[model samples]
Target: MNFETPSVSLNTSPENESHDEQFVNNDTLEFKYKVLSYYNEGKSINQCAKYFNIDRRIISRWKKVESQIFQTKIKRKRCAVKSIIDRSHFPILETQLYSWINEKRHQGICLSIILIKLQAINMFNTIYKNTPESSLEFKASNGWFGNFCYRKNLVLRRITTSGRDLPKNSVEIIKQFFSENCQYTKHEFFKDWQHG
Candidate 1:
């Protein structure tokens, strides 16, 4: 079963599409066999991928499966696992916001607003930690907090699941939280408001 069939030669005019389909259908198994043969012949995966028009990873996988099936005992490549910092660090914050929104459900608090508030606080904490001590002490307006809130709000509005018109009561709760935390009115700050 041959795998590396020579590239089909065409002379000028539109090539036959049906012929291409037929070749693929008829030659897939043979092609797989040939690909394995090429691997055994010491051709690098890059060379095979270039010749085969398939991803090199797929070729590597094929080699593994073939080796396993044939009892070749060739060890498969180790799949590397990467560690990332899980952002589930703010369960307390999430719970607080959830409670606030639940309490304000009548004032029209929606998941959209909840997500915005959480992201805003998260970004604020990040900026607050990173800002210079001189600027912090001088109280110079770097606009970091405003930008953080604006960007966080935009991202929340853009990337979140579709928002619902929050409960009429939740609106009041949202307004109250903003008032208590930053003395900013929802209407004065967020333009995406309607009289519900």
Candidate 2:
């Protein structure tokens, strides 16, 4: 009754872009950076806020976020200081993606990160088509793919299906066994087994 589970390798290589860099040049983040930069360069916060037609409190918050933005820009690339999850992902989309992945695996398909990401993008497009949001960008970046794998306890690698070693002719043996059994009734097969 004992069994074993096959081991799988996790994809640890860095993607084309750092996860932090995924948010680079985000309009809102860049706007905040510009606002803070202008403020630092002799413009008042109020003036920057008025110029952007945004609230002063938001400006103040961005001011507090200035250091984080600077650090992000310096360390890697421009990134949002405050993570806005509004467009990060759609939960239902991800759930459907997970199911799709499982279905593919069940069909003995080995899916890679690139394939999964592409599938995610395709699913997103298909599901949201005809809606205003369809035009919105959905990169299905490696970060999101990795997060999806992590959440679903899935790995992005070749599926390894192994079991206790059997004789090399196991397939033929199985076929012969089934063929023999098909020619016999239950009573005769078990009567022979009882003798064996």
Candidate 3:
């Protein structure tokens, strides 16, 4: 009985040849599996190059690093994505801000984007009170706010407005109640006031 080894073809088009070649080169795991498969089947290095459309030098390098790759499970060093605010830049301020947000959340308060931006500005001001002229200014721009929210996995939801019209004198009644209540000082009453 006679047996013949099966032939493998990359079947790449001229348009996609470079793209496919780059993918195979970048994908270490797939390349390793292919190399091992061809080697096990008694295929030559030149044969692998012709079938896989990869360089012979790359195949030699892969062979040299095969043991290390298998040992490390093909782990690759990845560069971490940078954030808008670095903790190293303003460590204390960031820590305080994080704590304040957690405290507010624990109190069951819903935060809006505007509210967060305002609070961030306040915190930045308070932390840098002595260094007013410092170059490290925190404008708390919309882009920075957005990135902060993303980094913290916090979602800012808008308050739903009621469409119904209020009765005439509702504002007067509210003002009267606030004035009569000893718990609300005149300053606090006006500060928390919202007119519809």
Candidate 4:
């Protein structure tokens, strides 16, 4: 209650803000949780707002749904908005993207959020390339990404290695490398091995 709103917050939370004008609450989900924790620690909403460089009104809104915010952070790493988004926005584009994701997942390739969003924008451009409206663009905002995950039943999890063991075909790969690259007599190790 003792906090006053500044004219404009020029600097936001470092390393967590995206200067996206449309989706202003571009702070990471973890950051949001931290802000709420700060507020819950007997700090005023206005104080948390000023300290975090976010709007006081936004801080208040987050306070109302503090529990949900924490749950969201647990479920995922980032969230653009806490409210529900459009159920179905881009049908064809989403269908293609979902399929692309499944295809890559099957290939044992884990795609990051940035990579997925970038691919989404690329797909959007390609899908709507012939559209008459030049304003049809997709920035692949985090909100959209969240909703996309929800609709597609995709879960984002931290990348962890299954084990530290090398591949079972390691010996074959090494033999292939030596056979393909260095058949010449210029290398001492190769000369010794050949003689041996």
For model 1 the local lDDT of residue 9 reads: 55
Pairing residues by index, what is the TM-score of model 1?
0.24
User: Candidate 3 lDDT, tens digit per residue, 1-196?
Assistant: 6586546446646666665666455445756666756865998888777677777776776666566545554345432223344544555665677778889989999777777778887887787888844557777788877766666667766769847788799999888886778697778767777531
Candidate No. with top lDDT: 4
Tens-digit lDDT track for model 1 on 100-149?
A: 54565558644454454555465445544654531333221235334433
Clashes of each: 16, 0, 0, 0
After TM-score superposition, what is the CA distance of residue 84 in candidate 2 from its true location, in Å?
19
TM-score of every candidate relative to the true structure: 0.24, 0.36, 0.39, 0.39
Alpha carbon deviation, residue 100, candidate 4 (Å): 0.3
Evaluated at residue 161, the lDDT of candidate 4 is 65
lDDT of 4 by residue, 91-156 (tens): 788999999999998999989999999999988888888875337667889999998998888998
Ranking by TM-score: 3, 4, 2, 1
The better-scoring model by TM-score among 1 and 2 is 2
Screening candidate 4 with a backbone cut-off below 3 angstroms (N, C-alpha, C), the clashing residue pairs are none
In terms of lDDT, the poorest run of 10 residues in model 2 is 8-17
Model 2 Cα RMSD, Å?
22.5
Global CA lDDT computed for model 2: 0.73
